[model samples]
Target: MSTETSAKAPGGLRTGVQKFGTFLSGMIMPNIAAFIAWGLLTALFIPTGWLGVEGPVEALRWSGSEGLAAIVDPTIQYLLPLLIAFTGGNVVYGHRGGVVGAVATMGVIVGAAGTIMFIGAMIAGPGAAWVLKMVEKLWDGKIKAGFEMLVNNFSAGFVGFFTGLAAYYWLAPLVKGLTDVLGKAVGWLVDTGLIPLASVIVEPAKVLFLNNAINHGVFTPIGGEQSTEIGHSLLYLVEANPGPGAGLLLALTVFGVGAARATAPGAFLIQFLGGIHEIYFPYVLAKPVLLVALVLGGASGVATNLIFDSGLVAPASPGSIFAVLIQTAPGSHLGVILSVLISAAVTFVVSTLFLLASRKRDLAADAAGEDKLAAAVAQTERNKGKASSVLGGLAGAGAATATQTIQNVIFACDAGMGSSAMGAGVLRKKVQQAGIEGVTVTNKAIANLDGTADLVVTQAQLTERARMKEPNALHVSVGGFMNAPEYDEVVALLLAQQNGSAEEAAAEETATHDAPAIDFGAKPDPATSTATAEGEAPEGATPEVLTRDNVRIHAGSATRDEALREAAGILEAAGAVTGDYLEAMKAREETVSTYMGNGLAIPHGTDAAKDAVLGSALAVIRYDGGVEWGDGDVATFVVGIAGKGDAHLEILQSVAIQFGDDDTVARLKAAETPDELYALLKGGLA
Candidate 1:
């Protein structure tokens, strides 16, 4: 789960565009080094290069294909695009997909001739891989054991052959035409002198975390092509300029209040020198009025670059002053430097004014202990609907001062009915009992998984689908509803995050630290636990829904059918349900497998057959070796339920939270008698 994203996102239109942008970036970000090498070669060895003094290197210029210069054109023309295709294919499937993607991209490169096939690869690479994936699914379970290799090899060969042929004739022309259209649009923007107006779109989007997409995904391809044609492209400087962020941080440092002010100086260095523009987004998010300063400042920088006709030969990553200078085309130093200075001055002055206007309120907020920076960071993640690696640069956002907060937890399943509802009920009650605050747990069908959830919980079988639907939220998989066992882990994680030092939240393990304290009652020190006879049920097990008779230590079961029948027999023998409930359980099992994830299965009558349940009660049977529950699922514990009008839900709510801990589950599995197992469950829940 992205529990993420205001940048490439979880929303509708914005999400679609962001995901597409992220897709393109995924294919390109890994290959930036190659582009840099090409840029350096062009900058140093060509006739107009820094090394134009003339020598063997000079003669081996772009015109002379005998040396370093010879490597330039071929590198960009062949290697870079192919690498992107293979990477995209790999993301879709694996090595086989990569091999097919590359072969298909070769067709694109050849068909397009003089034009670089960046866009072509972007389409054909993933497209071919997707087709292969779909084809494989057609024969997924039907492949004979021995003939699998032969069928698999032939299928891939056919896919690659057809995919390559399709790209050569059809996809190449369509993509080249699209590239030409975009080139024309940029030309029109420049010719009309309206190019600087792009800052209006760029600045606000940058604050929302779209900088990488705008710079690398959209701008880089166009700018790289332009640079190849004319030595440098001003488009490269549009999004890479760090002046707007620098100016905002400076103003915040001089006039802002509280955490925003305290963090500004450190953020400034990270932005202006370190080239990490994301360091200052919280400043703007904390005070949206400062966006005016950002836009005007960015526009001013673009205007200066336009006037000076100055631009970098390659993309300036991190947008740091150093990177910009390193990639600066010859004779453009004064222009580039002036643009950065002027943009910073513009934003600083504007932001300082805004801070002055709100100084009184801001001071009061600080006095009240309001953490605007931290709040904005949480808001950023909320807007994104998930987590972002770039966002990790923010110190207090989750890594420095406070861990990222999780406010919304979603429990998702196929229909948002039965299983998921029960799981949510269990976790929600446990959360309330533990006095967890600022957290709301809700269930929704996987199909309705909105981007707002900070965390998503699903059955293992449904997890992949959930991720595809909402890639920005955090996702957790649980095996069964009666034994949700993952609920405790989720709660502990939330606790760690809420306390501001989510110990495991550190994506980069730069230091060692003590583990956070977990509050789940399953683990108690021996000193605090009451002693009892080894096989005696605890006093707490006297609850009507659970007792010594409700639990079994070891049961022999070979198949899912046997497990369900034995479980129903236990419930019947306990007087919790009439014999008619067995048919209801069978019907429910036939409709939907009772098997959950891990090693737990909960069997119950259907809603329409609630009349069969004589009263509210529960039964637990453990399998020593575990029984096969079909579709690769194994059930070590079968929990049979009989309730009057949904009373089993309450029974499940009381015990589900205690099952998530590994030690807790292990203790139940190791219990030597029904009394011991019953005692463990009742004691833990109590």
Candidate 2:
């Protein structure tokens, strides 16, 4: 199925920038609350604050007294940077890495004590953690079985110690200098009245899902340092301004075509009020010409802020009116408001002109069922090179027009044989365990959507396209099949509808030890058509369809091509299909990913290559490191399928049930030998 992931990084410099920015943002985003806490204290207690009392408060802060103002310096100096380091390290290798990284970062902070060192923390935290990961690899399996914990702890301690010394002696000064260069460049732009030109870069990158990187990665640290010196920095306004996106959506609501026009009003409110600018991205991407409006509108906002010399005391996350106002620098409220307004007005007029010029063509295109925005949603996925959960949820925000009872739940993707199938199995298992009945859940390709199903579930990236395929059906967007919270939500909804309101079903669901709080909404029965409906399998115990002989534990396949070939070899050797199925498997993979979430991948043939099937069987393999499945995803388990009219569905369901949970995968990962792995697989599958 079309399972987009973060692996398909863009080519060359764009890829570097995007990945770097994403990595940086990841470390910073989690610590945003810390930054806000610091910002609030600074805004109220500092000399130029709203309070601006300028007497004992200033003296107390300078004296480092145990007062409200005392929190401001240490929060930015030690707390914020340390939090970022811990987060960055956690992403690399969990708690051990996090602790080491934070410890090493202390050296950098102390080395560059005069500088703010946000940039230094960004460098040392993940850098030291990465070095530690590589160092661990040198003796990974060589450690004596009994002394593993001792070696790991001592090795990490040594790495952190050296890394800390290195940071203090060398890295700190380099990062300090780098921050200075960036600061000077930004200053030059502001002085020369060229800061507005940054819109040329920021506006388009936002549409490409790179806004987080630009804001948190590059802007936040630099602006934060400036905010420490002055009360605010204009760099925060460069990327977080909501005016351009707001203007675009407003224009579309007034003069747009079909579904895009239909969804614009609600989308507008969500973008403006909630500061979710992603919902409007598809609109610009669907028609690239509209980017003109965004660039110019963003430029205007930057220009207005430049003229007023106004900026925010802290970064305005989500760029909503509320966030913007809350973080507005002292006496800059009018300037910030004027900038948002002026930018919106400029973009609305520019976008309106563009729409009018193309109104005739758009109407004609809509009449022909060419929904550009809907089509552009897929293009946007390609541009971003991965699926975003936030963007996915927006599809049904304004588009969920009707409430219908749930009976048929269709999990759709591009090819629909892989991820969708597993997702369907996941929901089916939940439905069965809940004792829900009568509902039929199945998997299908997006092209196969026929308006028969009451509910359609798809990856967030594909939700819009699925909506177009079946306009009347209710749509549910999820990040992926494995361990998606949406499954619980759906089950909860069904339980609620079958007995009471969503809130009422909470206690009923709570009695089931596995079920969490009630959040889903589906009405009544969920028989959840299992794969058994495809073709009846003979009554069996784990069947010949899957066996220890058909399983390969810890297989080493370096690349996607190798993984596909290896999977095909297992199926062929098992006599499940003729050798010709290998080519079909490759072809199928080329069309879309079979990489399901939670470290699972399923490789199977296409309909065109169905003739190669000799017997229905399944072959499972677990990669040691992970196979490089495209679109920025890694696959640990690769299941090759050769179905004779769905004879393998039962085994597929078993595979799904076993692989769908993180705890189960952890147990599988812990298996020390082939025999141990096979025994666990057999126990679970049976």
Candidate 3:
């Protein structure tokens, strides 16, 4: 697995911020369930909570039990720090790193008197993992072959021990001091009624995927301390506010076009009800200008809290509105509700303007046809070229062309579930429908990818990280995990490769170094020709709608029109069409580019051009350099169709389903012989 980080920002300071934010998010997001559980315990059993009831109802209240109340204290001090330590270390160096991190955190807990040990845990966890990783590198290949396990265990133990001692003597006190200073500074902000200004920092960090880090790492410890002093703290509500994210989604639901409009309502429900704030991160990323709205909305919500002086009795684990309501102080319900409403309204107004502007731009681009959209998509990918370089040597190689059948396809993400799981499910159904065998599709946390997968799919933001985790796997990044067009592309490539294996093997045997003399407008080879010796359809032969004569290898067309004409010429020679179909096909292309992702395109005439069809026929042409088919999409496989009525629709659908398997499409693209391409296409229809 590669360990390279994503491309660095232009400035060192910006790069550092990006790394810090990503690292912090990685450590806390996975342990959110634990945080929620802790919050529930604190909210229910604290002295002021429901468990504090002293009447006959006390029987139902665990707060009456001294043991239960005691449970909250250790949980707040110990459990969270331990979780953070393990997660941080695991991310850096896997399970062994987790063990060392947990061991090192013990010293920080003991030395700091358990005050804000989360800061200590963060330091000690990664510090210990780094030390252990260095030690392993130093001893790599030096340990006796049979005694590797013994050496590894003993070295890890020694490193953890010394690291713990170092934390106890030096790091703990230093971090504790810093934590105290930060706490006082925040307290001053609250006292001055300027706490809302903190949203300027918090909102941007949350958008950078640092919500979990800020809430769990920074705010939770400070909030816990404040709650102990005054029974609740507004600091807990600062980062956990769901209003800004909810507002953004609501705006998209009402005025956003395309996929955003369809997906926003579901995302809103998950975020506002289920507390999965990550759902909205991609939306903000797609249109970064909306960061302005998030920041303003967050500030407005914070201001509302300040006005009402609203505070939660405990942290809201998922930051869900329901959790907020549950943890709200007795008299702060109205204020809390108002905060959410105000933030949403602010975000909605700003987002609406941005959406309108974006819609206008999209309308102009659409009028230009798919070529503009394709070009835009291509440019976006080009911008990510630097970040994608984290794959290092694996970028253009690895499983992309590997002949070994893809045994495992893993959809990886930061948290593993949510979008990754949904993507995996969608691809799984497509794989099943395609009759793809011997392949396992699963979703895993990016850090947990073990390099066993043949292919890895992830959100573009995390592609670098995913590549680092499984460098040998073919990595494909998409805009969003749900409803991604890339899924179909990946599936097509996979199936093509899987089914084209035999053809590929055979072509290798016939490989030759000698190049045939070039002949412009040369007649087709008699052995592979579609027409009879008289330059007409063969007598008394069944029409082979897709035959060797209808297949063009490396046509190398300079434009979509040229590629379509080349393909149509093959069909006409095969006696499948009688009239000029080029104009009709070009008319269709004007309306929508025939180019689909995965380097394939289906160019056909309009319904009225059915008269040009003598019978249902398909022409497959391979363009080595690929013709530009509007926008930025290139069509390597220009499949020209001339069919009567709806006769060719099923075949078109089959072609779509076939190309959707990325492996098969890849194999098809690499096909060297017309026979090889013919077999693959015929097998798909069969």
Candidate 4:
């Protein structure tokens, strides 16, 4: 059962929706903890809450002070807006933008009389930050040397003032109107028994990583308004109902095979208790058809809530079952619990059918006999080699032959840390047990992969993306990251390759005919290769690109630009490139910052600035303090490249493969001497 399926919508519409969803999710996801805190506080201390007794008991709630409710109320009213503002601003302009965003949002909060101005904050925050960014761009290079701070402060303050005014005068009223309309529409849907239809959008959006946006941005605000009017709001149950997700996972736990069955139980706990919806996202993605189960489950849960007239007094921030119960109305506990059970039952039945069908298909394929299956697998392996060769446009025979020795293996995923990390650990253990030497195993975010790995393992849902990022690597798609069967298959393939290499060596020794030797280490000449070699550096380029003098063991640099210059200076000193290369590298940074996650950054000049390169070379600088490369990503190692053509790509690929290994990355970060770093790098390439 191939995990790869067409789940995304066709081109333009999908791209637009995805971009908008990502932007909205970015604004809310980072502040989920704050939201959860607010939700818990509201659930515990509000008048309708279990512990929200009035009179002397209320005074006891805070040791005879105004009461814990006093603190919770103000935090929800004030802190939540500030958090939304800061997150929106940070998304647009970083820390400075965050400040401006918060400042601008306060105006809307003060202006709006009844509403909390949730949507208003979203608008004012990003708007204020964008204005500040534009003003900074206009002042770039024009500001007097000693007065940069003065100009920047005044410009930001000026933008914030106007933004605040605009929010008070225009944006606040506009958002209030929109919020009221949405709230009324949602209330109508609930009244008419049509709220369950929301599952059509919510289920798909959740799978697309937009759960936070829909919950916090759209639903939470409307739910809050409705809850204020009534004692509780069914809108809160629309997205936060954990029943559907819990049901799907329960089914997987019972009937799923391999990793799905093993991980589902733990994932269920996390999803049901921790309120992390992301735990079940990969499961649905593994089989897009399971989306039907999710939607039906969600609808059933909503319908059950409708039947019982159950509602929550506040939003369930993590959408955890605990949060749902805590926020449920005083007399609605039984109804809420029943709703969850019903949803779980519906999802389990549907998912079991899908699982059985998938299993049957796999069994049917396997029944084709061992020899036929082996031949098919071998053909698939050969196709992968050909694909790699096509991507590199190198000598086809050399590229195909090089696949025999799998040096670097990477397991890539959407976020890189969760399933991919676990998968990489599993593979690493298997490789060690099998006594595979000189092989690097690692994991990375699919977007950050640099096409340097010999093998790339990823979820079937992300296979197309992995192919795009690392076209030269052999791609392996699996249903789940924790699948023992898939890992066993991978191990068997590696063992077979190793044994095949030994047999080939024996055959070569006994052969009577003379054959030309292949040199895998020699750089491919771009001029002789196809279009795939368009950017490749010529053969016989600089032999000593990275020298001892260019290596800085422990460097001190405060910012990304400062580190870039320091590394570039080393390349200049080495006569690899002229000083003009620094500007070229900076210019490239403006286009796309080279901070490649995992504490590594590769700063290189643009192709247009090839004239600045005297010869191909590299500079390695390590910062113990770690320089911030924007967006909270910090880099300990800054590699500056000054390659004239595609010649430098090989070195970049080697570095990528090296960094992919967690052990190597950790050792490089802890390396005490320049020699140690160089040795690691050299050994990785060799």
Top candidate on TM-score is 2
Cα lDDT tens digits, model 2, 311-370, are 888878767878888888776878899999999999999999999999999999888967
Predictions in order: lDDT: 0.69, 0.74, 0.65, 0.65
Candidate 4 per-residue lDDT over residues 359-465, each given as its tens digit:
86644544552222222222222222111111121111122333546777887755342345445655665565665567766666665687677888765435666
Q: TM-scores of all models?
A: 0.60, 0.74, 0.54, 0.63
Model 4 TM-score, all chains together:
0.63
- RMSD in Å for candidate 3, one decimal? 19.8
Query: Which regions in candidate 4 have their CA more than 4 angstroms from the true location?
Result: 1-11, 54-66, 210-213, 229-232, 253-289, 309-319, 322-332, 353-362, 365-595, 598-614, 617-686
Off by over 4 Å in 1: 1-10, 53-66, 211-213, 388-686
**lDDT tens string, model 1, 1-686?**
32112112145666555666667777887887777778787777655666643423544334342355666678778988999999888666556777788889988989888787888888888788778878887866597879877887898789999999999999889878887888889878878889989999998887775655677665777887887787778898888898888988999889988777777888899889999776677678889999999999999998898899888888887689988988887667788898899999999999999999999999998899676776575456544433233333342232223334678777775544346655776666556554467887766666677677777876544555677877767666555564444555566566566664344433212112211222223332232121111211123222366556778854223456666777788888888888888887776665445665446777777555757777767788887646656433557777887754333433443344444445556777888878877766665522
Global lDDT of model 1: 0.69
Question: Which scores greater on TM-score, model 1 or model 2?
Answer: 2
